[model samples]
Target: MAGSYGAETTQGERYRLSFTVGGLLAPQGRALAEMYLNRMGDGSTERSSQAKVSEKISEKANEKSDKNAGEEVGESIAAIRQQAIEENVLAIRTDSANRRVVAETTRRLSALTVEELAYLAGPDSSTSDREALMWIAMCRYYAIVGEFAGEVLKKHYLTGNTHLDFEDYDRFIADKATWHSELETVSEGTAKKLRSNLFKAMREAHLFDKKSGTVLSFLPSPSLADILRKRADSFGYLPMRESSL
Candidate 1:
């Protein structure tokens, strides 16, 4: 009673269809494989677009951050300069010669090139030069007992040497006394304002740190100092003394 015709006919049809499909698909399959290989060898536009978008986003973010940071630094420098003016006036009243020295120092500092100022402030570092100058100028102004201590520290710092020896600092102070004679006649108010602005500028340039509230020891390089001195001379300020030269 088995239907041999139905089973045999279905098996033969399936075999014929399988052979026909395989023969037809073999070329198509080879073409698809070659297309895949070519695509793998050549990158897609989507990847390039994605990379470009990522780069643009990063650049915009950095620009925004830099703009905001610059504004904050500007405000900080303004505040420090105001304080310097007050302190400079007070210091001058106490000692005229000290006032002269401070004035000369400030004038010299103000004359530095932007690049030189950057180098002085550790621009590559976190702290700004303007902030550092503000703190040092403040220390110079208020800490009458240790007037030139900050400057000496700055010099030592620029030289990549920070010696906290009291004797050495004292010797530096004594040596600076010789330069006092070179001070020009500058008004107390003007001198104070100048010192304040100079230090503020230094902070703005990233030569000093404002957060620790400590003055860093960053001295101008000799070449940079010479450049500053020349600028100062152009501006009618006293030249670098022989000892400093």
Candidate 2:
């Protein structure tokens, strides 16, 4: 999150492994997508569109009885928008008010294709679809997350394993850190936060049991799979049986 959103594996490229962003936050994602679409439909520029979304979030915050709490929420969302702009995720650079949360959120949202984003924010998407699609978005956005999905989750399923433990995550991270200098630099506390957030996201996506840590059985719907299949390397992020794919 401290560096640019993402980079290729090339030597000259800027790559930094960041996991400071929290879980899926599906509700917030949907809200932001809806607001973005609406603003675009109304002929607002990308900059203005994000500004409007921030304002709307602020207005909603203002409705709360506690003025201080309301103001804080407004400020946070507004700061996030400014951060997005500064990162060039949203057009037009601004002051550096945004932090890792802003960088991660904007990068995640941008990772999805317009069709994927529309489906995610639309009325027809089921809860499961939204969760799965969000997972796909995260994979597409962050190489670290995508590699974990492809390496650990997919391998675990293929090997007929149905459970995941912190050790699996620790081992994977440790192994990857050997090659990825970006990851090698992470402190233990940051790595723990990364693991916690990842597990939470998997649970929310219904890919893991909330209480038991058992790998849940899930496959994307045919329509959803079809959408993902159209994109190179995207469908493989999901842990699916070989025959199912």
Candidate 3:
């Protein structure tokens, strides 16, 4: 499924299940937000600012790259730079474990507003706020994850059943696979990693308890909540009642 972008299913729904990249990359997101702010603050046009930022980020990566590093590291940096150019975000160090940091970061950030990006990078943003916003960003970027959160998690929360385990993920994937051939094409190993990464992200976002896997209390900050509410259907992705907001 390396090049599998996705296709519309029989049900007229398109799903992109290529979420095997990074998981809740808050640090990278913060770094990118700061870089964006720096570039955008220079009174330059958006296009020029993005271009300069991309060039500088690539130069910085090349400068810091180890001279004696292996070919893989060099290639990773090149890919990272290319993704940075394509995504308009600064490229950071390559993760040996996950080489899609820049791509994933830009995708998540694309879901947010400049104000939201600033909040993520600002001094007032707490860990909880960042995590919640990151989860929202992920939900906005990936429709399948958003569907799981909205259809499965929200429904479970409303029904007073908070338990969320691998069984729940398996069932959700199985059900979606019927309407989403892309999901069906994912290898068992890749599917397992996807499930693991989703749970890891949810755990970090404080959506559930790490020990018991039970849904936890979650309420975004007033500002963040306001941002989401302004976006059509954004708040619906979270397992929260509208009246609660």
> What are the per-residue Cα lDDT tens digits for candidate 2 across 1-245?
23333222324443445545668756656655554444434434444454565454444423432333211111122334553354444232334433444556656665665455555666667889888887876776667778888898877777789788888888988887676676777777887888898888888888877678677767877756766655647656667774775
* Candidate 1: 10-residue stretch with minimal lDDT: 15-24
lDDT of 3 by residue, 34-139 (tens): 5655454553334445456545544443443343211111112222335345554544444533346766675666666655666676666688888877887787
Residue ranges of candidate 3 with Cα displaced over 4 Å? 1-14, 43-99
For residues 15-128, what per-residue lDDT tens digits would candidate 1 score against the true structure? 101010111111222222222222223423232353453344334334443333222111112222233344553244545543444333333233222223333332232232
Question: Which candidate leads in lDDT?
Answer: 3
lDDT of 2: 0.62
lDDT of 3 at 233: 73
After TM-score superposition, the amount by which residue 134's alpha carbon in candidate 1 deviates from its true location, in angstroms, is 17
Taking all chains together, the TM-score of candidate 1 against the true structure is 0.23
**Model 1 CA deviation exceeding 4 Å by range:** 1-153, 156-177, 180-184, 215-245
lDDT of 3: 0.65
Greater TM-score among 1 and 3 belongs to 3
TM-score of each: 0.23, 0.71, 0.73
- Candidate maximizing TM-score: 3
